[model samples]
Structures are given as structure tokens and as C-alpha cells.
Target: MKRHITGLFVLSALLTIMACKKSVEVLTPSGSDETYKVPQGNNDYDNTIVDYYNKYGTYMLYKFTEKDVYWTPTGWKKPTLPNGTWTTGAEVEASDSAYINAQLNLIKNKWFGFYTDKFLKKFLPAKIMLCKKVDSVFTNYVFTPTFTAVKGTKKVAAFYNYDNIQVNYGDATVNSMTAAEQRLFIYKVNLIFMQSIYARGLNAPTAEFANSADYNTAMTTYAQAYGKGIIIGYSNITAQSDWNAFITAMVTYSAPQLNASVAITDQTAAGILNTTKDPSGQIKRRYNMVRNYFINEYGVDLQLVGNATRGL
Candidate 1:
């Protein structure tokens, strides 16, 4: 009995030791694992990219794959690169390496110079992809009397350009742009910024401003939809689209221009030549609301941004 009891004690100790060994093996992490690293060419442009990342947490990606741009929808198969042989799928080509520096300069002077550092850090997307071009293809099926046939088509759909803010930087046109053209480019980039801000529900106006009866009445009454509490003719379709148009106008036109637009008296059937006047003062009211919201909440004056870009 004593011998048997001693054997049982030895077995118990060995079992405990084995269990501890197994636990340690399971808990230990691999030391060789590393994350994806951005390439460093040790050039000025690469240094600027690194500086932007360090300052604003935004990756100025000029060299990236299509996976970085296209997002896989839920329950949908993940997309793969065509490897230079694609007939029906999405693809994105990286910007020309030579033009990367010029594009970076344009972004620095026009985009970063306009906004405060704090604003860019907070509002800019995590990745801003600069591409030469982006394209996608879809395959449609048609049924004939005898059999089913497939039709492959190539097109650039907005859906293919998913999460990141993509800028198509074509050739070295930055150096040749006139002052007015430069300002227009600035306006377009800033419009993207404002659109992203609105889409994310960050620093947006309240429902009181967005859904106001005065604004709605003015929008519905006017046919042209400009200078009457909205910015574009298509804005009359939906309140959300109207807000987008309003933001577009705020970033595109100066305060004086918009105010002048509201005061025009000559009437026309096509809503041009200052035909759509704001008699109810709703346009002015909503304009003030939008301007004030940006100023009070973000310490940003939308009119000032527009005015600066417009060279006012």
C-alpha cells in the first residue's frame, strides 16, 4: 500500500509539470511578427510624407496597391489584383514616381496652407491616396432564347473608390496652372474636405438649421435652387443633398458673392440672372446659421476659406 501511494504522488507531480509546460508554450508570443511598413526612399518627398504622418497622423500614400483603395463589402468576395491581366474587375495604378514630388508640393501649398494644423489632424482621413488613374469593370449576364451570355464592361464607378480620399494627380500640370486655376484646384480639394466632414457627422449643423421650415420653403419654391437657401438645382431633390450643395457653395463662393446673389432683383423664367430672390429672408438666415456653426464649433469661417481661395 505504501509503494502504491508513493507511485501515485510521483505521477501527480509529473502531470502538473507537463500541464505547466503546455501552458507556457501556449502563452508565449512570436517575436518575428511585424506590421506593414511604409517604404522610405530617404528623399525629400519621402521625408515630407513621414513628417505629415508624424504631425497629422495622415499617410500621404503615393505608392499603394488597389487593396488600399477598394473595400470588400460584407458577404462579398475580397478583390484581388489582376497582375496586368484583368478583363472584368477593379484596379488602381499608382501615381507616376516622377510627379509625386510635384503633387506633394501642390498639396502642401494649397491644401495644408489653408487649414489650421489642429483642423487637419482632427478631420483629415487616415490615408490620402494619390493615384494616376482608377478603373473598374463589371460583368452583366443576358439570357437569350437558347442560352445565357456574359457581357463584360469597363467603367469607373464611384462605388469602386471606397474609403480613402483619392486624388488623381495627372502629369506635371501643377507648374503651368494660372493663379485662377490654382485657386480653383484649391476650391476642389477643400470641397472634398467639407464633404468628408459632413458625411462623418462631425461639426455638422443642428436639425433646427437643416430642417428649418424657412429653408425648406425657399428650396421647394425656387426652380434654380441657388441663392435661395440652396446651392445647386439638384439640391431640391433631398434635404441631405441640399446640405451637401450648401457646403459646396460655402466652400466654392465667397460670402459677398452669395449675399449679392440673394439680392438680385431681375426676374427670369430659367432662374438665371438673379431671378430667384430670397423675399422671406430664409436664404440669408440659413446662410448665417451655416457660417455661425462653423465659426462657433470649429473656430473656422467657411466664408474666409472660400474668400482666401477666391483671392479676395
Candidate 2:
């Protein structure tokens, strides 16, 4: 009996040792994990991306998969059309390596050159996915006048020709863009930057502008709204709506253009000039307020950025 009890104690000790060893092995971290690793290459393009990452804390991804583009919680999935057809939703192809240098130069000259280092560091998105093409296809169903189905057809929509900051550079190379395209490119980049400012609630309108009765009235037409210090009509009158309208005005017109419009006395209709011109001095007041906010808060003039995009 004494020998048996001693053997049992030894067995229990061995089991405990085995369990502890298993726990240690399970808890150990792998040194080769690439989950958070930043990709690097010896080429100049890769080096440029690394430099941007180091400087602005932004990842300029040129070579990435479709999953990188659809990175929301739901993630990438094949879409089922209304006609009961399973279709590939959106395709985000990797950018052509040959245009990397030209693309980088365009970004540097048109985008980064417009904003100060401080502003870009603060507001730039963490990840910028550069791609050659982003396209989507949908089923186009035709219906007869009597509500009968005629036929269903698939239509392809190409979005590579435009410059979208959301997708970075599309297939349209910098050299291939026409004069109009370049202007649009500048305008879009500037517009996205302004949108980022609004999203962050940075440089927002003051209480005086946001809460003023003159600026928040319900109007039937654009002219009526302009007279009341409002630039555009709003279905929902809230602080957020007011800010959106103000931002729309900022992106739509430059300082010189606004000033020119405000000075116009000639009217296309009685008591009203063209929609682009503001006669009541109300729009001017709001413009100055918005323009001053950016200058004072960010030490950057939004009008200058606007004027630059306007090709002034």
C-alpha cells in the first residue's frame, strides 16, 4: 500500500508538469508574425512610400489586393444582383509599376504641395490605396411600359478615368490627362481635403454663424437662401446641415470669384442676380467667417487652396 501511494503522488506531479508546459507553449508569441509589418522593397518607388510613411504616418499602398479596398467590418464579398445573379462586386487592381514615378510626382505637386506639412500630418488618412483601376458591373433590367420584364443586361461602369482620393490614383496616368482633366484632378483632391476637415469637425462655423436665425431659415429657392446668409437650401435644418452648406460654398467658389459675384449690381431678374452672384452681402459675411476660421485656427488660407484649384 505504501508503494502504491508513492506511485500515485509521482503520477500527479508529472501530470501537473505536463499541463504547465502546454500552457507556456500556447501563450508564447511568434517572432515571425507579419500582421503589423510594413512592407519594404529596395526599389525607389518602395523607398518613396516608406519615406512618406515615416514622415506622415500614412501608408501609400500601390501593390495591394481587392480585400484592402473593401476593408470595412463586413469585408469583401461577392454580390448577388436583384435578378438572382451572383456577380463580382468591385475590382481594385494594383497600379502599373511603370507609372509609379509619375503618379508620385503628381501627388507631390498637386496634393502635398498645396497643404502645409502640419496640416497633412494631422488630417491625412492613415491608408491610401493606389490602384490602376476600380470598376463595377451591375445588371441592367429593362421593363416594358405595362410593368413586364423585357430583358436583363449587364452593364460595366468604368471609374478609372477620374481622380478619386478615396481610391488614390486610378488608371489615368498623369501625362495622359487632358487640361480639363488636370483641373478636375486638382479640384477633386482639394475637395477631399475639405471633406476631411468637415468630417473631423475641425474649423467649424462659430455659434454666431451656426445658430443665427438669418442663416437657418427655411427657403423655397436658392436666391431666398442666399439673402438670408445661407448658400444652399437644406431639407433638415440642423447645425450639421449648416456646416455642410458652408463647406459646399467654400468648395464651389474662390475668394476672388465670391467677391466678384458680390459686387455685381446687374440682375438677371428683379431683385436677384445670377445664382452664382450674391447681392445681399449675406453670402460675403459667411464666406469671410469661414475663410477666417481656417486662417486663424489652422494658419492656412482655404481661399488660397481654392484659388489654386481654380487655376488663378
Candidate 3:
């Protein structure tokens, strides 16, 4: 009886050791991770927020064409002033609609259709917003293998935490309201999409890809655009409050109104003659308020980027 009992104890100890070894193996690094391609099935990568945006984000961006032309009075008019110059609302709407439709078609037929699979089905029905401008917009499409969504919401808050790396045209400026506003518009839209990804119970991908020096550089470059690039009208970002305010205003108010065809000429001319706030400059405050908040709340060490020139 005593011998049998001892053998049983030994067997239990060995089993426990084997189980622990298996657990350790499971937790070990997946051997110098690489961008593992999906075999077009139910892979986790296929369902990631990044992939969803890659396939559908552009389509969401293109939808703004409808909202864009409508937002500007002259946008819906036809163009007779010049071939490129917008003249009438009808023509403007038609022209823009054509381009937008084509963009939508590409997303639906080329991007999303190409990648449909079981994984995607689990996370369909997402909201997407398009920023008409901003260089880092491409980040919407880049794939990241690992990410965690907010605990309870489908909004991807990870972007708020990711290092504010900037990318192409590092710290550059734009020439016109139409151009500058377009970027602001795009930024707002992207945030909406981020929210959608979060709502789906998926977190935006984390900076885990930072393990790769190349990807790290890419992320840094992508972030720099927002931190250093021309901020359309605002001058600097000093705190998190600034970022929140800017994002709120951009998403809720500014984005829907800034479009290509509006001839603020009437207002612009009035400003030139009266020496008043460049009507554009008046709206500039909404932007300034955001930058100020960033400086105060976020602690961006670098000087803020602004319109007209690179002012603090």
C-alpha cells in the first residue's frame, strides 16, 4: 500500500510538470513574428480593424462626395466659368458625383469583394468616415496583426495612445482653404471609422508592430504628419485638450462644411476690403482652441504646426 501511494504521488508530479511545460510553450514568442499573410479563410488577421478599413475605408471616404458637393452651395451647380472652374451647382454635383461613384465602385468591387471570408463576416456592418485630406490617412489601410479594442466599446482608442509619429511631406503646409479643409475633413472621417472599429468589440491594432524597426519608422512617419504638418488654420497643439477639441470640432462641425466648390469669394472679398478677420481666419479660432488644448493637455514637446507659416 505504501509503495503504491508513493508511485501515485510521483505520477501526479510528472503530469503537473508536463502541463506547465506545455503552457510555457504556448506563451513563447511565435518565433520572430513576420507579416503572416492570410490564406483567405478565417484567420484572425482577416477580421482585424486594419483589414476592414483597407477594404472598406476608401469606400467610406468616397461617400463624402455626396456630402461634400451638398455642403457647398455652388458644389451642386454646373460649371460654366471654366472647364476646371465650377460655374453651376448642377454641373458641379454631376462631375463630383461621377468621381465619387467611381471611387465607391473600386472599393466595393476591387477591395472588399476581393477579401470577403468568414472572418470578415463576423465583423461586418461597420461605420467609416473619410478625411478629404491628411497624409497619415493611409494608416487606415495598413495591417497590424495584434490589437485590442476598448473593453466595452467598439471604438479604437489605441490611436490616442500610439506615438504621434508623422509621415510624408514632414511638417509641410497647404495653399488654400479647399485643400486644407479637405485634410481636416478626412481626419474627422477617419476618427469616425476608428469609433466603428471600437464598437465592433475590436481594439485598434497596438504598437506591437514596433518590434519591427521598419514598421516603427513607418508609424513614426505617419504620426509626424499630424503633429508637424500644416494644420490648415490652427497654429499649434499644446495639450490633449487641444487634440480633443480639434477632433470634436472637426468631426462635428468643420468637416461637413469645408468643401471644394463654395465661392466664399463674397466673404473673402469683404475681408480684403475691410481689414477684418479673413473669414477663414475667424473659423481659424475653432482650430486654435484645439491646438491650445493639446499643448495644455497632451504635452507635445515639439512646437505646433500652423497655417500661413510654421508658427508655434
Candidate that scores best on lDDT: 1
TM-score comparison, 1 vs 3, better candidate: 1
Give the Cα lDDT of each candidate: 0.60, 0.58, 0.31
Off by over 4 Å in 2: 1-39, 73-91, 135-172, 196-204, 212-218, 252-277
TM for every model, in the order presented, reads 0.62, 0.66, 0.23
Tens-digit lDDT track for model 3 on 1-312? Answer: 999999999999999999999998888586653322222234342344345456533112222243432232223321233432333222111113223333333334322332234323433343322222222211112235645221121111112111111111101122122544434423433343334334444432223211211212232221232233212223332333233334433333332233223332332111211112223343344444443443454342111111111111
| Residue 197 of model 3, lDDT score | 38
Tens-digit lDDT track of model 2 for 8-67: 999999999999999988885766533322454466788888888788777777765444
What TM-score number comes out for model 1?
Answer: 0.62
The model with the greater TM-score, 2 or 3, is: 2
**Overall local distance difference test of candidate 1:** 0.60
Error of 3 at 245 (Å): 7.9
Q: Model 1 — which ten-residue stretch has the worst lDDT?
A: 266-275
Error of 2 at 33 (Å): 12
Give the C-alpha miss distance for residue 239 in model 1, angstroms.
5.9
